[model samples]
Target: MIKHIVMWKLLDAAQAPRFKAELDSCKGLVPGMREFEVGIRTEGMEANHDVVLNSTFDDAAALEAYVVHPHHKKVSAYLGTLRESRAVLDYST
Candidate 1:
């Protein structure tokens, strides 16, 4: 399996809910998507990013397909406007 984790620092932290919603829209968007979870930083938590996307795909090919999927691209484009910085980690498990 491939784990794809992404954390984003938003330009405005208040937009975390919106960010999470946008990411949630991509759940089950492609074949082989095993799990998709979107999370907003908890209040008063020790964290650097405003939102996170923790997902798993059946394999590297599924991960690749998700990356290029049009819906994912659109969501990414919208999120780009709201993000200050992004951190990503992808690994096979």
Candidate 2:
């Protein structure tokens, strides 16, 4: 399985619900994506991102395909604007 993780620094809670809906929408996009999880930090953690995603795919190719998938790209593009900072890690097991 391929593990893809991403963390994001959000602007505020006001905008989170909208994107949270969209983030949930992501799960239905790529069938190759075996698992999808989105989280919003609740403890006001300063050194961490507000939003995070952890997903698994069948393999690296499936992960790459997800990266290039049109819907995924659209989500990524939207994320690029709202997030102050972002981090990602992709690995396989």
Candidate 3:
């Protein structure tokens, strides 16, 4: 399995909800997608990024498919406008 995690610092922190909504739209978007979860920083919590995407794929191929999927491309394009910085981590487990 592959664990794919992404953290984003948004241009406006208050847009975290909007960011999460966009990420959520990609849930179950491709074959072999095991899990897809989006999180926003809790109020008053210690955090550097405003939103996160925690996902699991059956394998590297599935992860790659998710990356190139059209719906994902659309969401990503929109999110690109809303983010100031992005960080990603992918590992096999």
TM-score of candidate 2 on Cα atoms, chains taken together: 0.85
Candidate 1: which stretches are off by over 4 Å? none
- Residues 9-91 of candidate 1: C-alpha lDDT, one tens digit per residue: 99999999988989999999999999999999999889989899999999999999999999999999999999999999999
**Candidate 2: which stretches are off by over 4 Å?**
44-47
Most lDDT-accurate candidate: 3
Better of 2 and 3 by TM-score: 3
Query: Using Cα atoms with residue i matched to residue i, what is each candidate's TM-score against the true structure?
Result: 0.98, 0.85, 0.98
Clashing pairs in 1: none
Give a tens-digit lDDT track for model 3, residues 1-93.
Answer: 999999999999999998898899999999999999999999888999999999999999999999999999999999999999999999999
Clashing pairs for model 2 are: none
Clashes of each: 0, 0, 0
